[model samples]
Target: MSANPQWDISKALMVARFFHLLCGARDACVTPFLTLYLRQMGLIAPWVGILMGTKHLIATTWAPICSFLAKNYQKRQLLLIGSLLGSAAAGLLLTLISPLDKALVYRFCNGSSSLMLPINTTLEKELAPNHSAGIKNFTIRTKRSQVNSRVMMGKGNPQRSMFETTDSSLPLLHVGSELKTPGTLVNLSLAERTRAQDRSLALSLGEHWLFLLSMMAVMFWELLSAPLGPAAADSLYEYLDFVDATDCYRRLWVWKLLGMSIGVCSVPVLVVQLDCFLAEDTPRAAVHFYGYTAFSILALPVCFAIPIPNFKRREPGHKAIKALSLIGNDCLLFLLAVTVFLTGATVANIENFLFWQMQDQGSSELSMGLSVTLSLVGEILLHPFKAKILKNLSSLGTLGLGLGCLSGQLLYYSLLWNWWAIFPAQIFGAISNGALWWAVDALVEDLVIPGTERSLSVMLRGLFYGNGASLGSFIGGFVVLHYSLAVLYKTHCVVLSLWLVLFIAIQSKLPQHRKINYSKLLAVDTADASDSEEGAERDWLIKAMRDEHLTGRAKNKY
Candidate 1:
């Protein structure tokens, strides 16, 4: 690569799109099947939960470190290294090993290799010729991929209205419009203008193709991984005695739910794809592992093909300080973190409790699968309306509504013993999980500075979902062991009620509009800006900071 490389954006995007698709394909083959893999290895309930939690814990721990490294090192180089290491780790899974040893290797590989996605996303943003155009392309492509995935899964076409909703929010080009140039238009021929338009259209089309490739990657992966979990659970059930099987299955689902929640909140790059080899049949396990390993190896060259512009390394000292200061200064962020944590715990508890409750009532694995599938469908259908919901209700109000829906679902579940009734309750699950998480995502974006979004996003995921799931899994497991699922539901309701009260209190105090005082927050030198307009902007910035607890030293820094 040239030292001063001016890459063709269209070609670069094509490479990126293909790379992401390969990544999605590889992960899809592995994650949802992990629980069954472990079961095949003869691991039981709490151990499953422990292993699942460990993976999240490792990933969460490594995310920040990786983020820092990506900033300072060549991103393409890091991608190459991560891909190679990941392939090696996948191959290692084929070997005979103790359960503990396998879990350790899996954690190391999963956590370290997971850096590729976030790094890739950041690299995409850096390389995009036009950020708004890229965002639009990404949204469109993701929607198309989602539709394709649903169709393949035998779900019918998604609502056409969803396309309209997504388009309305995205920035779109108005085609057939005349271009305004600085020079005299009379000097330019009609054919020249037409050529310009064609070039513009070509760029747009390239962006679309790029995004389509990325989404296809995700869609294909989802298709491969979706059925693996339920199938694995069924397989595991056959191996154990009835009582042990029920307990193991419940724990497996709980860990799976926790893993999903963490993956959603944490690293955009890291996905949860885990499967294990059969303990008794080493040969079969080797075959399964080798198949995935070969696929993973095939993905390596594709990683090298992605073209990311080199970035100069800056000392990351300011990163650490900025992160610490933001945490200390941002009270609302702290409260939101707490709210997400409690809310995650409540969701995890209720989901596990409800699933087992239905099963205990004689619901077959098929029925449980249908319930999960429908719930996922509901969530997907609700997603397009997320921006509108936030617009009308505000982030806090949307969250409140989601919490209310969750509360209602829990209440309904408590009152009914019938398994079928839970399906309708999934409407509540869909709204709460979908809308609430979206609200939180929006709120985080509004609260933080632009450069800090990735770190904050990872932090929130770890605090709210990662630690929350770990805590919930341990607590839920012990409670189920000692007490009844009914008891767990009752406790969940009370806890959420108390959390709602606290959330309301915090929401009341937050500024209705989330404007930050960058002058004070960033400590920009404004001494030269003595003009009235610049002075006024600086004054407004200071006041905004003051409202959020600006210190005397901070105020003077600018």
Candidate 2:
């Protein structure tokens, strides 16, 4: 096969963008609304937590298996199978199951269906053409689709109440003209070049596995919610199969956010409409299930129709190494994980607790929905400014700002008894959560070694996020049960404040460093080390050695 393969830009973008729309719609119908639906069914806080936790536990367990399949199989086929199975499971819950059976089927279906996320992202990256102009054109068309979806969905309040947190990691958009190419070096035999490529592939696969294992270990506490968005995004970039990474990511985000908005906004409308037609509560859920089923059915044909280009998979010749061997030595990654874990905890706490609090204060469904919509609108409006903010403040600095805002929002909620107080609080929450997520995304990309699996970093982040959220939800159920709402908010504030302090302390000690070029490592060049002594490769090696020594010292001091 030639080094550079040709792709149909128009077809690829259309498929990926449309697929995102479907997935978004599916998520809107289910994930965010599940909690509200359960609450409506008269389940208390603890039962809600337990059900959500069960789903997370099952999803986390299935992740490694899904990752393995993704690495080895035809991703498009896996996505199709997952979508069909998930839809069927949802159908069973909708049409056939009693209340007792609902939770089990929901958990199973949610986990099984989620497997499609990473596969879809990987396909999008693989199929997108590598030209700036093509990507720009694709983004323009995708935005129009998003606008149309939102308009058709209807807009009284911003559809924010049913905010389902999807994975935020997608392809990194590279806008620069000077794309990096392989380093110029002496010519090698055809056999040597093939071996080099094979070795590179094996090393990457091993790194990804190692990261996966680490995430699973660290995220064992995660028992609610799965973070699949970033993982999919990371996979898209990792394979190095797609062109114009940045443009691809932009299109993915636009379509995804749009779809989610539509899904979330539709729920209140569905509930109100269903209440009139069907006396039993089951009918509302059935409608949701049928909606997902219809979307899943439509998705399969679209998946098959997408003209995805085929790439040959290479078999690795070496055994995979331990996860720790590749990343255990990196101190920055550890800190990043801790931060991600805390962020997840705080976000989950806010998400789970706030809704219940609103209901307790006698807020109507429309009012609560409007609050959520406004919050989401705040988040969306703030997103475009993220790049500018990050440019001015370091990732850590931005994180601190987010944490501070979150702390203030919690404090406000704790003090105020009025329902309308949540409006300004939503604005604060948006800036806080949005900024924190954006910083974490950029930090993960920056900290990862260029040649290794970027998806692993994302997965690891997801693990932390999931772990924190699960623990938070479990503990939150008890906290809200045992204590006042004021106490819950105060507790969150204290925890975040502590994390902020630790973060600042850690940031103060970290070194200001140059970018490490891992092109040699990525190339897997078989040539002797001496041949590559004249350029950035030599400098990179020296910096890596120095960093390793410093890391050893830091470990001893701790």
Q: Give all candidates' CA lDDT scores.
A: 0.49, 0.54
Off by over 4 Å in 2: 1-7, 91-240, 244-247, 276-286, 306-310, 315-327, 517-558
For 255-279, candidate 2 gives per-residue lDDT tens digits of: 7767766666666565544332243
Candidate 1 off by > 4 Å: 1-33, 36-42, 75-298, 315-321, 344-380, 407-426, 509-513, 516-558
**For residues 301-418, what per-residue lDDT tens digits would candidate 1 score against the true structure?**
7555544444353445465456556766777777777777877677655644454455334443345445655665677677678779999998888888877887777777777657
lDDT measured at residue 304 in model 2 versus the true structure, 0 to 100: 59
> What are the RMSDs of all candidates, in order?
27.7, 24.0
Q: What is the TM-score (0 to 1) of candidate 2?
A: 0.65
